[model samples]
Target: MFEACLDRGLTLKKVLDALKDLISEACSNVNSAGISLQSMNPSHVSLVQLNLRSDGFKIYRCDRNLAIGVNVASLYKIVRCAGNEDTVTLCVRDKADCLFLTFETESEYKVSDYVMKLMDLDVEQLCIPERDYSCVVRMPSKEFARICRHMTQIGDAVMITCVEGGVSFSASGKLGTGNIKLSQNSSVHEDEAVIVEINKPVQLIFALHYLNVFTRATPLSKTVWLSMSADIPLVVEYNIKDMGHIKYFLPPKIDEDSS
Candidate 1:
């Protein structure tokens, strides 16, 4: 059993929301993910990693060189209950039970029983073999979210085409065509909008539902980064403070006519 506590209540809320979205979308295959936390030397930078191991899904973890696919929703809920204060601490009682305790000046909240079901989760981390990617894009999280939402209105899938100039998000269905283009200067937030750019032109199609789930982490991060290759899987990285980080991988669509 493991338990942890956090001091900030708002951070807990954001983390929970993001995890919920991941779990809901990653419902297919096994329904859980493994989470590990390691401390940085100065105790300032914290590394929280979530591993979803699935033979059908794939992702590249740069540090461990591992590829994994697994359900992440259950793990998200488990972490959400771990702490609720500004300063969070975690503990494991046995191999199966985890507890999360939050402390305020005069009050405390115990959320131990919530993580019980996640104990039996069977998750594996694969060694990710190296593969050169053709394109990478950096954009505002909110802007990406807007593009996803807009494309979703047109069809069940969104076609993403990356070019040297920029990346284009488009969806076509019976309703016609819906497109959102982000260039090197696209801004999602006035004060913090990061520049968007791509290295080469690579086009891939992704499911709208998955995009929606992956972008849920946008509210937690200032910007979102995407790495892609032609007909290869798409990687979405979400950076969260104090809590941890999440990466989502979606297999590229081969049949555009069917999508």
Candidate 2:
């Protein structure tokens, strides 16, 4: 059996909402540590990973490890029915085909339980090794989202260049060219700070459409980290408050003209 309760149901709702655009169904692994899910888009152009630590929950228990498959859209719908302040609890029997959800009002007045059928999604966990990136840029989540949104309006792709003390985003299309640069800001609050660390100058181009999708998680965190390296994928990570984090991996685009 596995059960976990969250003080705020809205947090779970937002997490699911952030993943709605990328994957439809996925398998969430429940263990003693917590719950985690990882899946790639249909085109495999992008991958998203979610982690929710056990210590962050109000109540958490896991007799044994279990893989719970679920439809992302369906779960989001059920969570949406919960009030913003309602407490949500997830329940699963030892070998049940359906996952149970309980929502309780803060005043301890109303309680609701929902049952959602689980699926048998063939999701294989990939081994992602940790390595140091050549450049890592930390900036406000809203700022990154806004830049991604605007860049898509001007071009299909955006080139990100990391220099000594700053990072730049540039896009070019038939409409025109647009460039935005941000230097390390030390005066602002840590959450709103823009800090760039680079071992060596590196520049890479990426599809703006996918980047815009990644910004869906902007609401989950105030700060976003961009980790990049030459001939490697860019890691966009958003720290989810007291819980864990959600990360998106997108590979750089190859310049066909240079080929």
Candidate 3:
């Protein structure tokens, strides 16, 4: 048997919405430690990792390690049924064909229950290696999403240039060019602000459409971290407050003809 409780049902809803655009189905591992899922996009051009520790949940228990395959969109739909202030509980027994969800609103003295069918999937877990990135940019998640949305109108890809000044996002097309520069505001002492760190300045091009889709995660966190390096995938991370974080790694766009 396995069961987990979350204070805010909307937290799981938000996280699912962020991944719904990437993959339709995934296998979630539930154990004593917590629940986690890592899967690559259908195109295999990007990967997403989600982790929520047992301590992060209000109540978490698992009798045995179980791999539960689920239709993410369906699960997300079930979570959406929960009110913003409602508490959520998920329960599933060994060899169960469906997962049960319960949502309760204390103030209103209301309760809701949902049962979502499960799936059988041969999900492969990848081994992600560590890397020392050359550039790390921390900025408001919404700002990054806005820039990507605007750039997509002009071109299909964007070139990221990170230097001492800041990080510049630019895209060129037949009509014209669009560039948005986010410079670090060192003077601002606010903890929730933009920060740009560069060890070795680098310029790289990536698919703007993918980046735009990635912005779907902006709702999960106020601040997003972009860790980039040459010839390596770009890492986008969002911290879910008291819970753990979700990370995405997208391969860079490189010309095969070039050395």
Candidate 4:
């Protein structure tokens, strides 16, 4: 059995919305450490990992490790019922087949409860080892989102070029080509400003749609980190306050005559 409480329900809401686009069902692992989820998209093009530490929660309890498979869409709908200041509690009994959710809003003088049926899922656990990417870019999440949104309108793929100058995002489509560059800033220092770090010049191409999908985290984090290498997938991570993080990995989209 386990019970976890989150102060602001919006954080959980954002996670669900971002996940709903790629996965319908998910197995959430609850343990003494915290809550975690690892899953791949149906097409196997992208993988997502989520972790929320126990201390991040106002109240957390777990007697034993538990894996509960749930319909994320239903869970998101239930979370939507919560008010802005509402506290959301997720709980389950020993080997219970249903997950109980309670929402409390004192100011609104409203309390809502929901019970969602769970399923037993057979999931394969993957050992995702740490990677050394060729280029790691840190920038404002909003700026990255805007670039992806605008460039996606011009092409089906986004080419990210990392060189001595900086990092650039370019796309070519029937509408013509679009490009956005963030040059290396050697002096500026800010938590939310654009920063680029590259060991050697490397270029990667990925589906524009996937990049746009990854941008769903813009609302949850001020800064976004992009790690890329030719031999490995691109890693996009968003650090949420008082929470762990949401990570995404998208395999590079390949084409003939593409470098």
CA lDDT, every prediction? Answer: 0.55, 0.93, 0.88, 0.87
Residue 140's C-alpha lDDT in candidate 4? 83
List the lowest-lDDT window of 10 residues for candidate 1.
38-47
Per-residue alpha-carbon lDDT of candidate 4 for residues 1-259, written as tens digits (9 for 90 to 100): 7999988888888888878787778898889999999988888889999899999998999999999898878888888888767898999998679999989985747878999999898778678999778889988898899999999899999899988757899999999999999987656656556777878778889998888988987888888999999968899999978879999999887865854
Measure candidate 4: CA RMSD.
1.5
Better of 2 and 3 by TM-score: 2
Candidate 4 lDDT (Cα, 0 to 1):
0.87
lDDT of 1 at 196: 43
Candidate rank order under TM-score:
2, 4, 3, 1
Candidate 2 per-residue C-alpha lDDT over 98-211 given as tens digits, one digit per residue, 9 for 90 to 100 = 899999999999999999998988888998889899999999999999999999989999999999989999999999999999999968999889999888888999999899
Return the TM-score for each candidate structure: 0.67, 0.98, 0.95, 0.96
User: Which regions in candidate 2 have their CA more than 4 angstroms from the true location?
Assistant: none
Q: Which stretches of candidate 4 lie over 4 Å from their true place?
A: 186-189
Q: Model 3: how far is 42 from its true place, Å?
A: 1.4
Residues 1-259, candidate 3, lDDT per residue (tens digit)? 9999998888988899999999888999888988899988888889999998899999999999988899888888889989877999999977667899999996858999898888988998988888789999998898889988998888998889899869999988897999999888767644457788889998888998778878888988988999999989999998988889999888889854476
Best by lDDT: 2
- Candidate 1 per-residue lDDT, tens place, 1-259, comes to 3233445545546755765643432211212232432111122111122432322122211222211222345545555554444344433344333333333432444433332222333433334445667887777788789889888889998888887767789899899998887666654444245454555678888888878867767777877878788766677877665444666666787774676
User: How many clashing pairs per prediction, in order?
Assistant: 30, 0, 0, 0
